[model samples]
Target: MAYQIFFREYFQTPPLTRAYTTACFLTSLAVHLDILSPYRLYFHPTLIMENLQLWRLITPFFYFGDFSLNYLFSMLFTYRCCRMLEEESFRGRPADFLYLIILGCVIALFFAWFLLLPFLGQSLTTMFVYIWARRNPYVQMGFFGLFVFRAPYLPWVMVALSVLFDGDLETELIGILIGHAYFYFEDVFPYVPGGWRLLATPRIFKLLFDGELENSDYHPPAEERPAGFNLGAQEEQANQQQRNEEN
Candidate 1:
């Protein structure tokens, strides 16, 4: 019984987020099991360009490292950011959320290629965190039960944590740059005077992923059948008094 309930809830996770988080988990698990190696996963331009190793472009964003406390925390954070962004900020707009993911990936890819970064799993998670933070600026979050701050400061705090713990900021900083660029173009520019929406989600994407679910065959219960926006809704049912019976 519990297993069935768990399966139902797991399948009900927002589709895009479920796919993304599942991919990240499987990638890391594959590495942990020795079925895959980091050497083939990390971003390397030369291997991609000359050797036609195209998978390098994708694997880096999913493979974080062996299982550890940090790895577990990063995955949880990634899942939370993605699920919230889909279920709240981008609610009812799956296509727009998809466009956001594609745009962020492209920007992150260019930066990773240019900077010769090996892995971007953490960086991609950071970018999602940054965007979620920007859109939800008023939500308060605590850091290791030490201090609490608003959502707007979350990304920078992560960067500081990275520096303090790992002594590295390159990957997280790259993510911040990509996140800010996307936030400005999508959220800020559209509202400015003499500005236009440069980051609008494409029409085809809406046609593909934004389909609305409806039940055209459904019939209203007899009690509510007579009320609607159209004239036909007033038609008498057997349960109602006929017109001839009225005074």
Candidate 2:
């Protein structure tokens, strides 16, 4: 029962969120079990171009380095941010959320290929974080109960922390840039007097994912007319009797 409650509360989420988190954990488990080498997962242009190893495009987004405390924390953070974005900002709009994921990954791939960067897992995680932060700008957040600040600064803080620990800002920066560009186009730009929506979710996607019933008057048929009920016949007989009395 406890395990059932845990699964219902934590594991159950919208379709995209569930798929993403499951993929990340499954890939991480494969890495931990030594089924695949981490070296093969990182983004490498030569492998992709000459060998047509296109799986590298997506594999990089699943690996979060060797199993450790950092890996666990990264997974949790990714799950949390993804859940918030999917359930809150993109609520009832799974297609739009999926579109954001595709867009972010495409932009990250472009940068990773050209700049010779390797892994993009952290970058994609940061992109989700950046989007959530922007959507909830007024909400207060803290880093491991240490420093507290508004939501908008969360992505920058993560980048600074990454620089402090790993001395590499490439991934985080790319993620932030991509996230900001998306947020600007989707949220900020359309609100401008002369500006129109720049990122329209495809109609096919809306039909596929957002097909909630819109008919307010719709209702289920009455339960099987209670075993041969004949109210219609009785009403017709009464009408005929009233007509005969009037004549």
Candidate 3:
């Protein structure tokens, strides 16, 4: 009963975040215990295509190198950022968020094939941070409680920190590219004259996850465009719909 309460509080709601973070933690534990090796977990394009080691495609996104202090930091950041994105921007829209994850994974794998970067779990984390930052541009972020900065700069700040600490820059650079590319198409381009939302979440995803809002935002009106970045493009409209349903 006590354990149930604890879990209900700590890991309650934001089901996707709970699942992802749990997978990351368990994968790290398995590696630390020698039950699984990092070698088998990395994304190897050649091995995947030639040898049919297809698990590598998804496995690498849940691993953040060998377990260590760096691993701890990366895992914590991923959980916090991912949960915030789900709770705020992706609120009540699990399918759309899942679509983002799937799209991001495909794009990551494409880059991995070209660049031959083996591991990319941390890269996904950085990309999530980028999107969250972009969405919550005005929110203040504190680092180790040492300093505060507006949210939009968070991804760049992390890239700078990674370089400062002799951390690998390739993963972060790739993440930034992926995040910004998605942001442009999803948020920015749709407002342009004669432009449409490029990656509208498919109806199948809605059936599986949302069960409503099949074509949530083919194009948002101009009046709402200004607040879309921070509050999520569909959030207000969704909330109003929910209220209307209740009324």
The TM-score of predicted model 3 comes to 0.85
Scored against the true structure, residue 108 in model 3 reaches a CA lDDT of: 86
Clashes of each: 0, 0, 0
Best of the candidates, TM-score: 3
lDDT of 1 by residue, 214-238 (tens): 3211232433221232224333432
Q: What C-alpha lDDT values do all the predictions have?
A: 0.77, 0.77, 0.81
Candidate 3 local accuracy as lDDT? 0.81
- TM-score for model 2? 0.80
The pairs that clash in candidate 2 are: none
User: Considering TM-score, which of the candidate structures 1 and 2 is the better prediction for this target?
Assistant: 1
Q: Which has the greatest lDDT?
A: 3
- Model 2, 1-247: lDDT tens digits are 9999978976678778788888888888898898988888989999998999989999999888777766776788688899998987777678778878988899999999789988888888889998888766556788889889988898888777776666348888998999889877776666557966687776666667677524311111222111113335544665787799999
Worst 10 contiguous positions by lDDT, candidate 1: 222-231
TM-score of every candidate: 0.81, 0.80, 0.85
For residues 160-188, write the lDDT of model 3, one tens digit per residue: 87787666689888888888888888878
